[model samples]
Target: MDIVFDTQQEAADFYRRMPSSFRQVTGVMLINSRLAVFPQKTADYREFAQLITRYIIEKYEKKWIMFIIEKYYYFTDAEEKVTILNIVAAIFSGEKDDLPHTGTLQDRHETIMASLEGVLKEHNTFSFQSIIRFRLTAYREVLRQYVEIAIDEYKLEQEYQVFVDKLRRIVHAYKPLCEKIEVYDEHPFKLFDEHHRLIRNVQSVRSFYPLLKQWGIEAEPSIILSLIALAPKQVIVYTDRPEHGMMKTLHRVFEERVCFARRTLHLGNGSDYSG
Candidate 1:
């Protein structure tokens, strides 16, 4: 029999109390089921539109049906590869939950308050904002790499090859000629692509979460990709929670390049970042 809970805690407690078989079922669902946000209006529509346009002609679109929850759909496609990628992108794009960060109501309440204040406020007195910004900058680098990878995959796909090739040429040709590409002193040149009026055609895209998720990376790898993209000379890890798997991965990946700094920090900003 299926069970429902009014509160998430109720559900968690139920799972914790379950027999091993039931617990295994829960694990399978979490791992195999593609997560989706409810209240369909919140799902990234731009990504949905793109997914339809990209794969509708592939002739296998009907293999799996979209698991609908109200207006939102999870696992729009049946293919495992495509589905995993979409989930990854959606999670990174903040379209879905961060399973690792899930916690009690107290943690959520604190996060909500912090988010409400907006971490990067111009008037805030938080001394740790600089560190947060630095961390964010590193994350952006990782996103950029994934963005590139997604584009490359599109270009290589047989169905998308012609369109991708044409777009690539246009982008390359427009590169030298477009005087509109704004160059930021501190940020990567790719970030400016959105600001150009000529790219307005592409700018209408509100979400690439589905496309980005296709990479099948967890939270830390996503962050690490962003760090690599930024290519910082030095990095300091500031945190109150030592359980983050990404930090451990960083110790092994970057070795001496990364170090920990004990700081009293609060979660900030739940806003979804653009790719």
Candidate 2:
């Protein structure tokens, strides 16, 4: 079996990184500036195909992703392109979880491996570039889907940053209604005064509703609205789930004013506070 590369460097790289077991059975040579791998034993063809499949996935996958991004999408800002690429990398590496329309990187690898193995079995010598361009349609489609997901994620991240910036501006401009407030994270979220007395009259929060509406921000959670209305100089939240979405928003908006205590809050009657 023979596998050919377009560039001598790529050929050298594939040959250099070949496992010792495979290296013992294969010989590499340069032909017309292209590298070709020739395995001595015909029985080792399957193993050689598997090795090439892995090499393509591990070394050349990112280059394919870059090609897809550049060919299909146009971004004026270089940084935006870089950001999208980073998101694609995260998704491909399985660092980003629970993606909607894509399989795990391992799944993609297996799919490509199966396709490549099928092609390798039928052909004794093939150009690696031609194989990718003509035979890997399914793999390319998967990559395009990944690029789309990355673009979507990048847009959401940009919108989130804008929202956070607007909230920070609002928080900075608003006067404090109280010196401090205690928040207990619950279904509805419980608010307490500085003395740990439950605050029942959150109707005061309605006054700030119109201000947010004027800025095209509306229908936010009541806890978030109340916190904005109160605009306390300090906010101490008692919750084990500091990574909650609401907590992240509060921390982003309040910056130095928010503190988190990672423990459940128990009221005096031995019942957990419920809002």
Candidate 3:
């Protein structure tokens, strides 16, 4: 869903309007994704680890097929949507596997709340210390997700158009998501695109893959999809994978194609593109 805040403050105001709980859930989801990137000894799941390894071997062709199965959803199919709507009330009346994944992130909201409460038995602080301690890891994670998507030029040609199309729709369809404003004792933070650096260096694919795997991250295709959704696919999907990123990838892949048509891309300022 596209949610464009008129201003950074407007976005913060919208987040505040949501039931305080939903925001918390979003925070948890984002945090959990972060943890998945660089697992902690205390939190790592051996089984999940093996799954990830096997997932890598599989070349991640699953494509979230189960999501489609569970959703029984197709964006272009209105009749199927109507069928799901018709069964909404009686969905619970089903046999076993019909249930959803009961992972901690799901079907345990109340229990998680209780667990968080037990851990948060401090001064109800939300102090700078508390914020950093609880949130820095995840905030950095958000940045990393942005980075992973922004670089990796190899996949741009394969995916930029799809992403640009998606972003165009999302940005166009975006509406102000929040209407309620909360009185925050601590000033909220904002996201700035200029804050990110773009990558352009690369010579060959072999050199690129090792560098990418070394980021100590599992670069999922969904990341590619997100890059497509957020920026130009041509900006990513570089023909040669050296050390690159989402935008760099597009530059490599599409710069040639569009450049042929005299549509050269300008990959601008970003962090020091280094290992």
Candidate 4:
């Protein structure tokens, strides 16, 4: 089904509200097609809309034939539109084995041209190239936008991979290098700072930043690995989140050297450390 936008503002508004997923490609195509009546627009939006529409049509030709048919009706001459509809119906009406090979764009295009030629022979007036010329001229901008989106998605994926690799390295760095040894701590420190007490209302990574600063650690993995390397005979963790990832990593690295703190220190409330 097609979503008709009667005004440029309506189409722009719809596009803004659309989700940035594959599903939005259809809306983009519909909006761009409806806005085809407007002129002097940049190529980016047109390229994006047409590229997605072409890809979807290629991948699921049968599923999208009706949609394409509807879109064409709005822009094509009556004779050309009739020829396209007849060609589509004739190609899909036959047995599945008679369908053209769609292994590649060339194959699909050749299949479509062959069908078009066969149908056009009856009228002796329409050519596949003529219809394509109109489409290419009308949707040239869409092709440019398609290229831009592809590049953007590629860059985003690379960034995601880099972040994931960083995390993996941190995990691997803390893994035991040799047989486990008992740690001896000369200075036992908790995750709390000298200025703040544990507030039950807060729950976020930022909440621990001040505490980490007080503990003289810059990174989460740094503190955990540092505590292990310090070889604390007993490292006391005064945290309610005993099952936290950092605590678990510590236990895995230090084995029996890590211990849970039995007392709570309210450094934020001006409480004195008895240790």
Candidate 5:
């Protein structure tokens, strides 16, 4: 029989004990699962949000069912995406377990958080693990800042500690799955486009993660795109002012040059992203 939980700890415990065949952890339902079984240390919100978003969307959203957990919901249908993500703000800033999903601005904030959670995970992983690194050189500082702030806002200190401890116990725990994205003296993941793209976008390989996420990448990889940086392709980021036309001839360039850096940069090369 299908079950619904109004609490994280309760669901976590149940999901942990249940067989994977019939039951699974849905969205933020990790309180008593393996997390409950183990002790926590660094619940960094950056990591926490990312993991929660990924887990929910990857497992439930694709199923085309709106699995709403207490306040958190996972459904990819464009119309419902924003409404569900908003549920996090209630969870984040201390709202009731069953938040009112009205079309209010408060709900809007929560919705944005959920969307950010999904986008941030893709961006961070791409920045840290992509095959191409040099292309990301320019955005490294911004990306790091993002991680710091998101973690802080998410109240993720406990999560971060837990990740560190778990990573230590496992093989290649901190080892990234992408490629050179993290090596750029920074990261590759960024809030790249104001709008999605096609040809010109791919020309500059550095911004692949943001672009991929915008494009709603089909491979749906939790992979490190590259470990070794490759030569970056140039593209212009248009401006909105009068002098700089919407299509100004602004050429975006990489801070450095990389070469045949690493192969199998992403995790989906049929290999494990963690490995």
Candidate 6:
């Protein structure tokens, strides 16, 4: 069986990296600008296909991904393409730690292996590039879908950064209403003054309402609005779920001004202060 690849360099590299046992059973030689692989034994065809498939996945997957991103999606920005590629890798590896909905990376290896094995079985001589272009339609489509997902994620990330930047500006410029504040991450969310007295009245929140409206920041949760409104110099947040979305937003917006505490906030007399 003979497998022809587009570039002599790739063919030579593949041949050079093959195991000695496999090399003994196969012949690799350059033909013009292309390279051809010849398996001495018919029994080695399956192994050869597997080797080639693995090589493509390991070395050429990123290149193909970039190609798809540029050719189909028209993303010309190098940094943007790189970010999307990283996202694709993360999706494939199932390392999207917080995204459990993106589905598993099952069958990707088996799918490509099966496609290559099929090509090898049907043809004695086939161009690897042609197989990738014409034979791997399903695989390429899957890659396109992954790219779409990555692009969506990238846009969401960009929007989040913008939102965070706006909040950061607001936090940085505003004067602190108090020296310190403690926040309890409960259902309704609670805030306490530096004296550990619960701030129950809406007066402080009301005071910041106009600023929030003026800055077009009314979409944020009330707790975030309250915190930003108060703009405390130091914020101590008590929450067991620090990985929660709201907590992350607080950390991003406040930076060094925010600290997390796992224990609950103990208020004096548990009474609400109108102040």
lDDT of each: 0.34, 0.75, 0.30, 0.40, 0.31, 0.77
Count of backbone collisions within predicted model 2: 0
Q: Candidate 1: minimum summed lDDT over ten consecutive residues — where?
A: 30-39
lDDT of 2 by residue, 1-275 (tens): 55677777877777777777666556655565455556556567667767767887787777777777778886647677778889988987778767776564336666676677666667777788887777777777877888889988988889888878887888898788688888888767878876677877666776777888887675665676688788889999888888978789889989999999965757543332222
- What shift in Å separates residue 124 of candidate 2 from its native position after superposition? 1.9
Worst 10 contiguous positions by lDDT, candidate 2 = 266-275
lDDT tens digits, residue span 23-125, model 6: 6656655565454556656577778767877787888688989999999989999999999999989888777635534675335566676677777777777
Can you write out model 1's per-residue Cα lDDT over 170-196, one digit (the tens) per residue? 323322322222212121211123232
Cα lDDT of model 3 by residue, 10-45, tens digit: 334434444444334333222211211222232232
* Per-model root-mean-square deviation over C-alphas: 25.0, 3.6, 26.9, 20.5, 25.3, 3.6
Off by over 4 Å in 2: 25-46, 103-106, 269-275
Per-residue lDDT, model 4, residue 35, is 26
Clashing pairs for model 1 are 40-72, 85-213, 85-214, 88-213, 89-213, 138-226, 141-226, 142-225, 142-226
Rank candidates by TM-score, best first: 2, 6, 4, 1, 3, 5
Cα shift from native, residue 20, model 6 (Å):
4.3
The best candidate in terms of TM-score: 2
Residue 32 CA displacement from its true place in model 6, Å: 10
Q: How close is candidate 1 to the true structure, as a TM-score?
A: 0.19
Instruction: At residue 236, give the lDDT of candidate 5.
Output: 23
TM-score of 4: 0.25
**Clash count per candidate:** 9, 0, 25, 13, 42, 0
- lDDT ranking from best candidate downward: 6, 2, 4, 1, 5, 3
Residue-level lDDT of model 5, residues 1-275, one tens digit each, is 12234455645644555435222332323432223212122234444444433444344332322223212322346544433334343343455333332222233223324444433434422221121123323222322332233324333534544533332232122232232232211133221121221112332335544643443332222112321112213222222231321111111112122221232233221221221
Superposition-based RMSD of candidate 5 using all C-alpha atoms, in angstroms: 25.3
* Angstrom error at residue 187, model 4: 33
